[model samples]
Target chain A: MLRGICLEVPPGALVRIEGGNGGGKSTLLRLVAGIDAPTEGRVGGRPPRTAYVPERFPVALPLTALSYLTHLGRVHGLGRAEAARRAAHWLDRFGAAGHARTPMAELSKGTSQKVAVVQALLAGPDLLVLDEAWTGLDARARSELDLAVAERTAAGAAVVFVDHDPARLAGVSDAHYRVEGTGLAPVAPVAPVVPAVAPGSRVRIRAAAAPGSVLPPGLSGRPGPDGAVVLTVDAARSDEVLRTLLGARPPWHVRTVEELP
Target chain B: MTALLRYQGALLLRSQRWLAPFVAYAAFVAVGIRPGDPVLDSLGYAAAGLVPLAAWLVRICVTNEPGAARDCAAAAAGPVRVHAAALLTGLAGALLTGALAAAAALLVCDRAATGPGAAAVAGALVTVVCALTGSAVGALSGRPLVRRRGYGILAAALGSLLALVLAPSPARGAVSALVSGARSGTAEVPLTALAVALALAAATGTAACLAAARRG
Candidate 1:
């Protein structure tokens, strides 16, 4: 049975799912992939246009990378020749051209995993579900995978990947979550920030802060000894709360909290 | 359904990995034959060729990804009937190929002195029986509860027992009379045995196909 689990991912978000082994991480992905049924609670969403790479990559029999991917393309409604060409392109991209004609059984586990990855990517799924997809790869392969994911997300695709090593995905993810006993809880957003304004100009904002609403914590409209309110925010709520305050009507001409010197 | 059949058939044929052993064994049977009673020789060739073919087909039909099975079911591909039909079609094609080769060999060798017509008919019958039995056995292999190696051994044992009990006697008079189409004494034995084999094959094939369709 799936225990308390909840998650909400915005479109085009690069979300990382993390959990201990046997924590239903892969099971969650399978349920999302429509490969398994949940015992009790409902999983709500439109049937996703998705590319799911399972923990154990499943390769179809008797078909070469080209042929198998081409078949998958056809299954997704691409023309046969078009599918073949795209498949060939992906194989070459993955450095799998030398073994393009090899049957899946003959390929090493890593090679097969690459084929599985490419197959999913070629589908251009709206939601990409990758379960432990980062396992078994050299640094170079991992970099290639990161690049592929970046390209897909740049084109506005939502990607959800399960990974045991968070550092491997450091630069790639926009958001991270830990799957606990119940559901997913936001761990943090991971993005490098550039200071846009000085610290004294930064401001604090509170929850339920709406457009045109005055900034809370006595920082609205009051000038300090230095001249501006020099908004100071509690660090915990600074990211989301400050962004909301700055984006409100009248548009605060203040620097973000991090910009404060 | 047509699309599924084409997809399945193409995969099975192209894999070559699965079909290679069966082909090799069939070749071995063709090469191993020596002169004997025409009917008995044909029967022996048919039985020998069928054993490996059944084993291979069973393995192919059962070893599929559980995830893929779930996906296929979710996609509204109808029930197991369509899948079973496709698998059976594949097995039938393989059987036909083997039967044709065996019949051609019999015709060329004329070792049985039974003429091409009788040899061809017997080969076809034997091929059908074997194919059906293989398909049935393969369907059973797909069950999670059954161990494939154990199932294979059991099927082989059962088949050998049936062959031993039903095999024609080696007596020259009986064998010659059966081959010569002389209906005086013991015509009923061979005919009854063939009928029972055919019936068993048909029943098992149908059952296997049905079971596969439902489970798949």
Candidate 2:
């Protein structure tokens, strides 16, 4: 039971909720999402289009991912065609497009979580509430979801989330609160941390490809001196970029890997 | 509301949970109404069976979704609309099943004694009234009120029984009107009972929907 809990989330703001396990974090998020009515207090100013993603989406529903997302899109007030389009778009964006027709009951945990996230984004809701929504996602999908959250906030939507990862969207949240025993308390925002090199450091890779061999799909690089191609990518993704180049037919020869200062 | 209804209807249809109550209703009709039973009598028996079936369907619809999915839907639509959609879908399913059962009774029962037209009208009215009353029973006995599965089922069964046997229950009154009409060779429309059932259903639905958000 929560009492004397007063919180306000404005449009375009990202609010982070922090609390210990079973400390009413989920309950607070539920009230904010209008999933549950407050017993003694009131939650006002909720937008009409709201979406929520639960912490554990362990549903083995009868519908397929695409069908379930389409239904949710319509529930969020989109037309039939628009709902289907958005459902497919979001599914593809999250790298779950291949599983669109797969029955929900047969989906793996991470894929089901992807579908849950896709359903929330399909309608472009004005308010998005996420309770441990990123738990089971892969690193790629986790980053994709981070980007999606950024896009939603940029589009003037309010986002409230509770995640166990301390670095999840750290320093970017506009507001922060901690759920205490029976009420909410405002917590100071975490200071943005700056490394010697900016957090998203880049790597420059020089590779020589066979003549007349087309570059791998989705790989873009500039021609370097002496016929070598120069590719710049985030340090975190340099491995994947290298793997893609080497994994191609008649693999490209790596010349050098230099850290971008 | 339309979208919510559609979503809930899809859940009920695709889940195939409707089959249990449906088959039960069908079994009740097949076993009770023989080839030569009186038209009104068969219909009364068929309609009586629907009360419990309707309540069962409502419980199924309300609880069909896993808790997380229900929360997702509740966030998209309000909790009240979602709850109301579940209740309405169950009622709609019950009404559809009742119609089919009534039709089957009309086809097989001895309708010469009570005119087919009178039997048809009375049967349809009682079917509607009983379904409505049964839905009300379901709304009250479902999730928010009775959280435990064992107790919720007990409450629904007991509630349906009371709805059918109570002296002032609209379902009871309507079914009795059909039975008395069968004996007197006259058609009596249970308009008053219908109104009462409609009101009861609306009140129960509103209460359950409101409580869903408050009590969740």
Candidate 3:
């Protein structure tokens, strides 16, 4: 039931999509990952080299874990020996070395999830779309995943992941947006109240210098019900406001607050 | 084409569990057919009968995963022609395997009467036809329209017809005519017919690949 939702994720950033079940969170991930198309609206962006791990693990055949991973690498255009070597290395790192030669079907659910994670990581894609990727991992495995993701981001890869446990990704994510009613709205930052200004009271603004820059066009400031001024500053005048505000002497307090629409 | 051949061959070898039993059954049928002056006729019949079986195997391989048809479309390979070449190569392997089984049976029956060269050529030709037909049918099995009762009816009718045509016949004129024609060194029919069949098969397989690629 989604409609006309648009979002732009910047390069080299981690985006966390949070929402209740049956709310199209997975659908959005699938669309972004290029696994599915949007019913309406156009999605435009560079087709980032991406790897997607679905909520349900898809293991091809009953081949050994190493064999399957190696095959996946080859499918993605990796050479034979190099694919094998990389797969082996990741398997060992994910504590799956002992089961490397074992058929994938024989592995437990948690073990299979570990293999999926290593496969996605080994691809080293420009974007990683994960759907509940942390569902069945042990604590150590989870830590390894965090380190791996951090390393990827440091090396300039973007990631979008969906997880039920928000606490696990608290500090790792750069931005978190919840899917609500076919659209996304940023999670507003909590603002500290200014006790100095009473609600419903009008304050006169002393010239303070006869409007040094004529308050540049398209720059308007209005007070909200909570007595906080919301400034719709034009991008061209943003630098002017910053210069004027920051250059002011003591007794002047400036706090930037973002509002959710 | 090389990649497709190598991948299909590896898959075949790894999934030897089901194929091994099938190969055994084919061997049993090949041996059970008695050898005599009518052996060539019997072989022609047997080769034709194998068409449906070959088709079933191809169907299993292609449709093993419900999503495979769609996945195949999305593969980042070059043109659809390349995929078509690969599929044909894989089918060739399957056909060759069947031909080998038939050749083994012919060798065991009467090496003196059935020269190795003739057996090889005939087996190869028959295998090629069966393999192509089988692959085409298998490809259709994944189509929504064919997945219905229509495909079932078609399969049953085709299977029954092949079995009947391949059944041994000791009839006089047509059988004698074919045998004499085969021996008279009139190589044109078999050679030309095989070449034409192979060309058609390649074209059809290519078409299927292109369709899949476009859909993907």
Write down the lDDT of every candidate, Cα atoms only. Answer: 0.57, 0.91, 0.57
Q: Mind giving the per-residue lDDT tens digits that candidate 3 earns over B117-157?
A: 66556555655555555555544443321445567547634
Worst 10 residues of 3 chain A by lDDT: A203-212
Which one is best on TM-score?
2
When only the first chain is scored, the TM-scores of the models are 0.68, 0.75, 0.70
DockQ of 2: 0.66
- Ranking, TM-score, top scorer first: 2, 3, 1
Off by over 4 Å in 2: A194-261
> Per-residue lDDT for A198 in model 2?
52
In Å, residue A51's CA in model 2 sits off its true spot by: 0.4
Error of 2 at A107 (Å): 1.0
Highest DockQ scorer: 2
Model 3: CA > 4 A from native: A1-11, A18-24, A34-49, A58-60, A168-261, B1-11, B24-33, B36-43, B63-93, B105-119, B143-216
What level of docking quality does candidate 3 show?
A: incorrect
Computed on C-alpha atoms, the DockQ of candidate 3 is 0.05
Candidate numbers sorted by lDDT from highest down: 2, 3, 1
| Alpha-carbon DockQ of candidate 1 | 0.13
Q: Taking the tens digit of each residue's C-alpha lDDT, what string does model 1 give over A45-128?
A: 633456776565555566676766676655544667876788888778777877778876677878777777766777577677
